[model samples]
Target: MTLPDHGGLSGPEEIARFIDDPLTSSVLTSMADICLVLSPEGRIKAVSSKKGSPVTGVVAGWKDKVLSELIDSMSTEKMRKRVDQLAKDAASPEVSPPRWVELLHMLGQGETLPVRYALHLLHDKRHVLMLGQDQRPTIEMQQMLLNAQIALERDHEAQREIDTRYRLLMDFTSDSIILVSVGSGLIVDINHNAALMLARTRGDLLGKSLADYFADHTRDSLVAGLEKPVQVGSAAMMEVEIKSSQRRLQLSGKMFRASGEQLAIIRLSDPGAGVVADERLTSNLRQLFNHGSDAIVFSDRDGNILAASETFLNLTDVPSASAVRGRSLAEFLARGAVDLRVLLENARRAGQLRMYATKLNTDFGAQVGVEISATWLDDQFDPVLALVLRNASSAGAVRPDTGSGQDQNMQGVIELVGSSTLKDIVSETTDVIEKICIETALELTRNNRVAAAEMLGLSRQSLYVKLRKYDLVSKDEG
Candidate 1:
């Protein structure tokens, strides 16, 4: 087993002895997944696979078969050429490195195995040694990487589609919308409508402070309101005048979190932009509805109150417009459903009813004679009846039988004459007159109980007693 003093075998006899050793096959199988001894004509003379290799049983029957038969048809010519080249190299005197070729081996049952084979020239020169590395694991790794790339591309495409939809919605919406960063108070994004509203281009608006477009006095309040938590029943919008145009607009905002950062989405809209053709005319009409002397009430087709102006609330003795909203308008009519039915019928038939005489019953059980003008608004989306009520007594309308010179209060008392006994009528009339006088005094004194008591010639304690009896004691007063 010992070699001569040289690093390699000394003669052909020693090399042949080493190749025939029992350990040589084990050594070759350990170095490669599969080892094959091929004849000069490319036929498989012998086959050996490493222990526990996947191709061990697959290649077991390949001995004495042509090498090209075990591989796929595509690899047949390549195998032939490699074997021919190896045979030529073996016949030459020059030594060369082993040549490696990748081949696809056709395993039966529609399966294929990839193997990288290196052709080694044997010392006998009549045969070639083909050592192959199992490329299945490497090929499987490459397939896994390909699948991952495909999945990534699909996910990227899906993300792009979502982004495109979001952009379209933001651009096409009619409302003026702007996105601002909470930390920086700077504009992050703005839609076309918002840019037009602010009198600026989208490029000029981005990365700029939102307050820069608003009046100096309102900038701080506007930003603070945007950052505050939204509350139900809170004022959703505020009036702001644009610095450039001096045009007033309603600004409303909502706060939301995105990408782990806080953002504010604000909407700026003209108060009368969509509702009317002329903004100034709309403003004038709005002021008239809110502050006019006449009471105005909007009711749905079903006679339910949709909205009420400030004067309407005052006339009905209600605390706020919300208190009467959604309630049947019949509740405030003197004859209840009878009066409401007549007003609705007449308005619908004629498109408008002019100065229909009726009485409005207040929450405090007092009735005021009113002349109602009802107009049917047949809006396609929201049909409503607009009723404007003028106080008949304040308008100096003549009272029937009570004489033109008779006061309205006395006329009301006189009207109850035939319905009740003399004593009952007197008692009720006294109470009614007293309550009216007390209310008038309070109104004249601007709700100052002390001054009202002085004006009414009553002590503070007595005034309080009468206030409680009339249920006119306000929460602050109590």
Candidate 2:
């Protein structure tokens, strides 16, 4: 069917035809993704949206609302400026090209959608039309790409920082470090010291074989050492003469795995050169132990003094280590045999005794109260016991025999005062106490002779003699 041309109709007839035409609304709706008719004052006059679009939710109840209420803060000023520009252009004969402004449309649920819009001035000059293209998907894609780029930059920066620190440490250290390829045995990298030791520039030695730099007679040994697996905490030391360095040089090699490759770490040092103990260090240690407040003494398992510090001599009223060496520690302990024997036994059983109350008996018969911290050093070559005696008298008066059991025993002694002579009463009391103590020690040790002897501060023979004297031992134990 042929359509009549609107040019052939009169002015009034054209107006009537245009008002009755469905294409008027259809053309406005299809102009863009969204269409808005805004009054000269920047208020929304009418709104239309494309089917199945995000703008549909945005334009739901926007009619007659101001443009500031319809868009986000960032776009409110842009919309006002566009309306003012259109009003100014309405009076000008020369029409300006459509100006596009990117805006964020505010939806009912408080979500904002990005939209790029252009304003067109109507002939009536009282209203303007806005055509928008959805910019949400484009903006989201750009943002995601920007985030990925930023992460890539951060990774590169971190790797560069690590490389800088590693390079600084490698160059600053004095030890020669060489990285060799396990597959080809070629030098992969070398520090400055290694290059200087090899008498070759680093660039010249970068790809050279490790064994080629050693003396002709030692090349085979170096090659064999490279083939050996490197175990942690184990090192193989050998002597090699470099071509430039005529002196015998010590080479120690150990195996390590890094970045999926096994490599040998060979260190170079002067032969027969090692850290020697400084005389001042030994002097310091001697002064520390000999003059310190705590008296330190070293003894054998049998409680024979192996060595005694000066503090020990002062505590025991001895002149020097010579005065106490090889002497039984029991002679100086106030309890005689009992204290030293119990100390050694406990040190062996528990590795250490923290605080054991005892008395240091001086040759002048003065008793110095002390607490002993003893440790048993079970050395393979020279086993010994180390005792640290701290002065306990300074803390308080000497500890009294104030137990309930001791009180009762004293009471028994008191009760015999009127019944018998002092000598007879003392002999009877001593026998009864000895028998009870022997029985208690046997019970405490679960009938073990060696342990019981140690607990009672007696030799095995002495304990057996006492057991026989008191008839405290069973036939099986004897």
Candidate 3:
């Protein structure tokens, strides 16, 4: 969150410090999980965090939107609960409680998502406090959840040896399970657990056609293909997949015809799990080697590949996985790792190397080039790299030197207008009459609108509009 500018304050006075008290300013400046303060009517009032909270710097462009309206924060159930709880907790005089949020899965680059939340209300203070945990685990989370679902299903009958064991199994399973009226495909039975998982109430789900829940693919197939094929009984295990807001779920189901009533029970889990019933992940591993999106050449720090994904081998026109693994990046490129000097040096400084390009060659003299970005997961920052290798088009978008970066930063704006980056901060602030100094500083600094504007801008307002358009005025005619 950038503070507004203060035009001319004699000695190193930042505009942010002038408008907000030092305490408030410290909270705003602290590298903690960011706070989003909303008004009772639900508009955002302030965004800040306690000094000691865990998370640090965040990306730009998401600075000042209303909390409820932000895309990344809106998607998680955890965040939804926090917003609701915080809003309510502010009302009661009951002893204030500590609240926090958790973010379980690693969202894509530059994304912030909370997976769980804890809430505390400061009734006397009329504020809410939240501490968020970054639970952004790797893809291992998907596999772990998949394993958990399988274990839940397998031991389900042991929990209850009664006839209701089947019912309990159908209801409490982690994967989405449903009992459908086979011919009509209406959802005859629904479970509380699955309902909760799906963010749906039992009333809303019961008696609804299963077709209503599925996407066009499943709906179309079930509608045209087989409303009543022969009940396959024990051999009836079938798998169907549907996309959810966050991830894909594949459901395995079985059907039986009894007294002219067709009852079907379905079990859902990750896509690859159903086919891996024997817990043999060999086939899935094969797909990783042969069908992945990137040309993955797995290697040690010294660049000896243990394996290469099929996409990688194909791109280089290499015929065999056998020939690829245990080869060095230098060997795969057929020359040596160019740009490694800059890459290794930058990664040493940043822990991540991004948008950098290089060339590589394969066995048959086929040379292919890619922009490879990597993040180090190694302890003490060893050379364990997770690469995002992109083609030329993806590469060209991120320029090392561009006016885009220059226009986006207030500091850059100040520099562009020939102002000292430090002097114009007072102009971008909210102090009464602070804006005039900002305008004068810009003028005195010889047309450095950014520096002047920095001292004169705001916590929120037309500063954004002017930033995008570059229109600023020193004279307040009104």
Candidate 4:
């Protein structure tokens, strides 16, 4: 039905005339910086943009141009589709959904600026109003977000690859390895060998208490042994009899942290059934210790030498074991009597004195830097102290290097004499020396805790304690 051109009414007919009026087109232009009036054929009937609008640079000569001509090839097809949709909706009585399309506005300089156009089919059925929003900033932001998502996906894929390799190695190893949660005694992971020895599938053993699988009487001992590594900072071994498998197995456990959670790795091995073989192995180990590369010495409680290895005799520049016999161990050590007292005192209390860096004075009057590991062997028929001395003089002195040599270090200590008490100066000097040794050990071992501990002749627990005392751990790691 057609409406009178100049009649006032309160229905769709009146609204249609209002939308067709030029005043409504001007109002639409005010709503956006760039506006376009398009015919049903997708040709631009009018174009308008606010003064100083960036869109003016690209859309200046768009009047009377087809919508397809004003936009790039891709947007031309999209505009055609939108126009077709609009025509179909105009024929129907239904109010169609608003159509939004992103178009590229072409310029004379061969550059294209992205334009987001909101299209509405006017009541006239012959024209469409297009309001454009500059989409450069929004599109650039979206592209950046897409790039970040891709990078995140790549990181996740790489992590998966690493996990896969780790899992494969753990499973294929012959060693029976189980990963257990420290908080709960439940096994979190197990290798193929571990799964077989437990007489259970991997799924059955995972998340199950390891202690529960053993004899009821041995559960407490088993748990305590597994947890020992956390305190000692290395693997501790214990023998446990598995009730399910009816086998005696030796378990060695090491504690570790991953993702801020404490975990323990327990390895199970069976000792072969032979007493004679065990005795032979014991003899072999004893022979190795006596003939080892490091100088070995056994002394009485009073530091009198009882026995000396050939290496020790060579180190002390003594001709034979008889020549060194009955001689006080301190006579050849740092400051002679003082160094011997310190070693005996520490060994008596802790049963061991390890990595004690000091000078060993030889028979020729030459001093050699050595690291001493002495242990109190009180369980023997005759109580004696065992010392293993590793020559470190050839490795350069243990004194802290200030870039200058030993003379400069000695001079610096002498310079502290006027301002500091003797005790204070000695304590500071000792601290500096210990710090330098720890740093060098860490560097030489490439920051590997196990290797560094061995290099410094200290237990892993001792090294960790000293690391904390000296505040040597990196701030980021802490």
Query: Clash number for every model?
Result: 0, 1, 39, 0
Show where candidate 4 strays beyond 4 Å. Answer: 1-34, 39-69, 92-101, 108-110, 133-138, 141-145, 216-232, 273-478
| lDDT to native, each model | 0.78, 0.74, 0.52, 0.76
Alpha-carbon shift of residue 418 in model 2 (angstroms) = 49
| 1-478: candidate 3 lDDT, tens digit per residue | 2223322222111212233355644543453444444344444444443333333323122234444555454344665676577656556667546656664423357554543434444333444433333344434587799899999977876665664876777666676777777677788877776565445788898987776555544544553334444463342333343334443555556766767897777655666645665456786666765676766554555556666677777767778888776666666442254243334444555777666655567677766677677665466655564455554435454534323423445453445344444345444322313333344434332344443344343432455454334434433211
Give each prediction's root-mean-square deviation over alpha carbons. 18.5, 15.4, 38.5, 20.9
Per-residue lDDT, model 4, residue 79, is: 81
| Pairs of residues at least 3 apart in sequence or in different chains that clash in candidate 4 | none
Task: Judge candidate 2 against the unseen true structure and give its global Cα lDDT, from 0 to 1.
Answer: 0.74
Q: Please give, for residues 1-478, the per-residue lDDT of candidate 4 as tens digits.
A: 1112322212222223436665665566666667777776677666666445556645656666777776789988888888788778778888778888888877647767778889887766677878888777687899999999999999999999999998998988879999988777789999889888888999899889888877643445666776766445678887777878788888888878899988888898877746679899999867866688899899999999998988888887999889999999978885666567667867887888777777888899988888888999986577899999988877454634434543555577789999999999999788768876787656434466665676667999998998888888782143
Q: In what order do the candidates fall by TM-score, top score first?
A: 1, 4, 2, 3
On a 0 to 100 scale, what is the lDDT of residue 27 in model 1?
69
Clashes of 4: 0
Query: Which runs of model 2 end up more than 4 angstroms from their true locations?
Result: 1-33, 72-74, 86-98, 108-110, 120-127, 133-139, 142-161, 164-174, 183-188, 200-212, 215-227, 230-241, 246-266, 275-478
On TM-score, the stronger of 3 and 4 is 4
The superposed Cα distance between candidate 2 and the true structure at residue 55, in angstroms, equals: 3.5
Residue-wise lDDT of candidate 1 within 44-102, one digit each (tens)? Answer: 76776666666666666777788787788778878878777877777788987788888
Quote each prediction's TM-score: 0.50, 0.46, 0.24, 0.47
- Identify the candidate with maximal TM-score: 1
Model 4, residue 30: C-alpha shift (Å): 7.3
Worst 10 residues of 4 by lDDT: 1-10
